[model samples]
Target: MNRVVVVGASAGGLSAAEALRRAGHEGTITLVGDEPQTPYDRPPLSKQLLGGDWEPDRLALRSGPDLDALALELRLGVPATALDPAARSVTLADGVRLEYDALVVATGVRARRLPGTDGVAGVHTLRTLQDALALRARLRAGRRLVVVGGGFLGTEVAAVARGLGVEVTLVEPAPVPLAPAIGEQAGRFLTRLHQENGVRVRVETAVGEVLSAEGAVTGVRLTDASVLPADEVLVAIGCVPNTEWLADSGLTVRDGLFCDEYCGAAPGVYGVGDVARWYNPLFGTDMRVEHRTNASEQAMAVARTLVGPGERRPFAPVPYFWSDQYGTRFQAYGHLRGHDEARVLDSDFAGRRLLVAYRTGDRIAGVLAAGVAPRPLRALRALVAARTPWEAALADPNAG
Candidate 1:
């Protein structure tokens, strides 16, 4: 490819550009980002930045000299407005048209917000650096905060807020937080962890509306008509892929941009990161992982596919993710979603440690561990990678 245009300036897009250079691509690369800031790590936004432990400068993914060495044409703060697959060109909001021989769509996702809460003070969504800074400014000791989702984001924020001496109330629409993503047992464990840290846990409830007065949020009303008085509200229900710019691009776009086993959306066009819902041959399904590691790993894979001399190989990988709450660390390997069974291989609730294995049919689909040593967790991850049979995995002494 003579020219490469990468849409998105975050982890995935920046990784792609860096990998292309490392792979000896001497052609032109144009990186487009809606945010004006240089590429920064996002995982810290919820934990360190929100908790007042880290500043925005500390989130930089690369130093000034390092980024400058890439020789990239950086277009920051201007979002892409449209894409023309036939013309192989992208139109930016600033009316700049960029042509490319290859394209990488890594626009990623945006935090989902509650309805009718726009322009309301004391309401927030933690997706961007600015979002974290704004929310952090509002957090302080004795402040009452209400979090509207039980996913990883909401839970982590709750943990950090609690550490800041803030009173936190977590509201979940499910029977338990993260029961659908993880398992009910693990979810319950997390719920108890939050409670032990002095957070009020509310399950099987939905926020009916954000109660506001004079354009300032006062509290939230639950579906049952119960009101949660709060100084601030964080809506972390989910995220929406940044695909609106590709509406007329003739590429398949639904919940995410559809791609093949090679991450190809069309000849000379590919999708990466959170914006990609690509077929994974290892799992025999199509999925879009929003994890930090996946973004960088997939970007390197796509880079090799683009610049490699040989035939492209199928992009199949054992998915992995992790979360930190209170003082415990939770990590998982392989695909845990849709597993029919989960077996607690080990437990020590008092010590805050556990290892669980998830099964689909006769094979081990995933493994999760909390507060486990790195060496043991690595061994467990291997079992999931091998697709070990359910009984065989249980029989193996080192499986956990």
Candidate 2:
């Protein structure tokens, strides 16, 4: 392709752009994003970014010198209003048009906003650096923080807020924080952890409305007619794909832009990051992973596919993700779906290290653990590539 356009990128688009430039693609490459800032590591937004490290070097995905070297055309802070696959161009919100021979849609997902809380001030969602910056300023001692969801973002924000000595209350409709991802057995582990940390975690709680006065939030009203006081309420319930613009682009969008095994959306179009729902043969599921790793992996693969046929491998990488909370670093490798069993080979919640192995009917499917044990992620790609059996992984001391 002589000209390539990439849109809606957070984690993967940056890598895909670099990989394209690195692979000697001597063509006009345009990277477009709605967010003003360059792509940085989002996993840090809730962690270190909240801790107040907003330096350019730390948050910048591509440095000025690199951008100068590549001279890649960038249309930052401009959102694509419409995409036309037939016309081979995109219409920007500013009414400008961008034409390309190939298009990589990397628009990542956005945090879903609560309906009743639209007018509620001090209520926020953490997705971009600006969100983290604003939230960080609000996290001070004596501030009553009502976290509206017990998902990863909410839990992480709660952890950080509590560390800053803020009063944190977490509300979740589910019984535990991560019941949707991990089973009840593992979710209880977090419930106890939150409680032990002096965080008030409310389960089976439904928010009917958010109370506000003077154009600012004050508290939340539960469906049970109880009103909880809060200085700020953060909604981390869920995320929606940034694919609403592609509704007319003719690409299949189911929750996210659905793609084939190679992250290919259409003939000359593809998607990466949180926006792409690619089929995973290993899990036998169509996964739309919002993790940082998926963005980078799928983007690199897509970039290669656009470049040449150097290697034709299905876009299947061992799914891995990590989160740090309450001083413990949680990591996971492989798809933890339909796991017949999960055995705790080792655990020291107090020591901040634990190992949990997931098996799919006698075959090891995934592993979640704490600490810097990288073996699971290192060999996981090969294992998934080869469809390796779990007997050998279970026999290995590090994995089991």
Error of 2 at 264 (Å): 0.7
Instruction: Judge candidate 2 at residue 183 and give its lDDT.
Output: 54
- In model 1, the runs with Cα more than 4 Å from the true position are 309-311
lDDT of each: 0.92, 0.81
- Cα RMSD for predicted model 2: 2.2
Tens digit of per-residue lDDT, candidate 1, span 1-400 = 8899999998999999999999999999999999999899999999988888898899999999999999999999999999998899999999999999999999999999899999999999999999999999999999999999999999999999999999999999999899898899888888998999999999999999999999999999999899999999999999999999999888999799999999999878889899999999887889899998988888899999999949579888888888888878899988888888988888888899988889988988888899887876787778778888889988887876
Worst 10 residues of 2 by lDDT: 377-386
What's model 1's lDDT at 196?
92
After superposition, the stretches of candidate 2 with alpha carbons farther than 4 Å from their true spots are: 53-57, 337-340, 360-362, 372-398
